[model samples]
Target: MNTTQLERIHSGKGFIAALDQSGGSTPKALQQYGIQEDRYSNADQMFEMVHEMRTRIIKSPAFDSEYILGAILFENTMDRTIDGQFTADYLWDKKGIVPFLKVDQGLAELDNGVQLMKPIPGLDELLKRAVERHIFGTKMRSVIKEANPAGIRQVVEQQFELGKQIAAMGLVPIIEPEVDIYSADKAASEKLLKDELIRQLASLDQDVKIMLKLSIPTETNFYSDLMQDPHVIRVVALSGGYSQAEANEKLAQHQGLIASFSRALSQGLTFQQSEDEFNTMLAKSIHDIYEASIQ
Candidate 1:
């Protein structure tokens, strides 16, 4: 493990930036950024366009480590360069931010009222490559749609199972098991998910601490116990499908949880904004999220 990065993450006073939109979600992300599908003809062009958006965000004046502890990258972005340095290196060396990689292949079809992650082939190889690039950790996601114990157990189990492998490689894993915010049984699902997580976390060895990324619970401080667990390094909240305003409002009620937002983080950004306008908007967003995180 990178002890410096580990300590920074354990004690950092900022939210994480989730910039890992993959192929399936790239169009929506680009569209929100004021780019349309017609602007790109193929996959390569599509990726190029999205990469440009990510690069612009990373290079912005407001994206420093002061209110942004880390940023998670897609595999392509991880392999790309920023201002003549690898993306991870640029984040750590130039901006004083830690870097993480999104490792899941994406969720599988909904099953048993949940959507577990698809198998991640070559994960070990990917972890090795991430280590070479100075990556501090990784993130994977699964989803819970209803209050089904069987399904939630499977999701949590899969996350921890893979988390151990990631830890064995000396990389901390942000195990994300997201509960759909719009589900009728959202609160119930959150409870079941939390129970399962505690059960699984208790079985781990003392040295194998991990991070968690979860949807902001319907009840304020619902995850407070998990935050106090010694096995958990930190508990971060995903914006899920909430708008930035709504997400930040919910996040503020939880003192220890911080944000790791995607759409929410890039909410008002557009491809055509002037640099000054872009920076101003970004600075506001970062400040709002940071305030809510530390509240």
Candidate 2:
């Protein structure tokens, strides 16, 4: 995949990871999120999904050409029953696009042995399958999470190694941190992650692309505030159903790398639901804060 185009689509327009309860293989379920119906159940769905995606590209009203539509294929999406839809090649076929497998997949790999972390049991075989058919641009990998504090240095380093192997095979890694710390001192929490991420990036071989996933700080700092430290590379936030205006305010403030999430469409006692004014309240405020960080 062209890192330039992938970077362009992700710079301001971001990706959303699915927290949906549906089993991952169901193409029809993917349809709810604007994915193609043929994208599930088997590999045969690629033709349909790619065709529809092109149509949407042609019909988009907003200047969305710079963005991409993502179907987050997390662990739930990895069921063999739905093998056709979630494989590495299905994603590689699309131009400048990313196939977002959930972060949990990588975390799970840290324990099973680092080799398990590659795209599939035999990613080479899969890519060989793609190459034989002249497939060249599909990038694959997962939204990432540092599962435990133990052995994290090894985990991060090895993951970088995994990314290198994948890149050799032609795929990009969407590095992310799971929102695991909630209710802690927000400032300290952010600092902990920010500091460590910088350290990890420093540990890497130069020229590797690392994307930092951060939540829209509703009760924290602004994007500019986070950018004060130069160690940061990319900033990602939620597009999870926030109002376009809410998302925009955040976007305007984002200064570096940026992406979106789907948390806004979710409902719970903690969700911010006041529509009183776009200037303040809940997801809007958080999104505004996050959008600014990504800029």
Candidate 3:
């Protein structure tokens, strides 16, 4: 592990920019950027367009480490290049932001009121490649839709189990077990999920430390204890389905939790805007999120 990068992530006062929109969510992300589905003929073309979008954002002046501690990349993007350098290299070398990769294949079918990550057949190989490419860490996601103890337990267990594997490869794992914001038992689900996370975290070895990316809890400071846990490097909040305004408002209520937003981070950015207009908008977004993160 690079101690410098690890220290930046541990004590940085800014939020993480989630640029890792995978195959399953790429179309919607591109559409929001003003590229229509009709613009691409196939998956290859779709990825090309999305990569272009990501490159433009990264190249923008507003996207810097001063207000953005790190950025997550999709596997495809990690393998690609920007200005003759690998994407991850460009991010850290030129932009001064730590780079992380999204490692999960995608979600599995809903079971026991939760949706776990599908098997990652080539994960070890991928992690090796990530280490070679200067990636500092990785993120994987799962979802909880109810307050079922059995279901939430499975979710946390899977996350920690995979997290341990990731850490063994000398990379921090951002374990995201999101509680669906619209679930009827949203608060109950968060409570149950928090307990399960605490239990899983307690069982880890002293040398292991992981990050948590969770939905904005229904109750403010609901995960305060987790934020202060020794095994947790950091606790970040996902916007889930909330708008940027709503997500930031909720994020500011928690003193220690920072933002790791995807859609919310890219909100209001479009392909049609002039360079000046685009940079200005992105700067504002970064500023707002950074301020909320430090609160």
Question: lDDT of all predictions, in order shown?
Answer: 0.94, 0.40, 0.94
lDDT per residue as tens, model 2, 106-202: 3244441222233346656654544343232222222223333333344455555555654466544544443333324444444444555556666
Q: Which clashing pairs does model 3 show?
A: none
Q: Give the TM-score of candidate 1.
A: 0.99
TM-scores, all candidates, are 0.99, 0.49, 0.98
Please give me the total number of clashing residue pairs in predicted model 2: 24
Give the Cα error of residue 65 in candidate 1, in Å: 0.8
Off by over 4 Å in 3: none
Clash totals for all candidate models: 0, 24, 0
Poorest lDDT segment (10 consecutive residues) of candidate 1: 1-10
Model 1: residues with Cα > 4 Å off, grouped in runs: none
Off by over 4 Å in 2: 1-63, 66-120, 126-155, 181-187, 217-233, 239-257, 262-295
Error of model 2, residue 159, in angstroms? 3.6
Worst 10 residues of 3 by lDDT: 227-236
What TM-score does candidate 2 reach?
0.49
Writing each residue's lDDT as its tens digit, candidate 1 over 86-202 gives 999999999999999999998899999999999999999999999999999999999999999999999999999999999999899999999999899999999999999999999
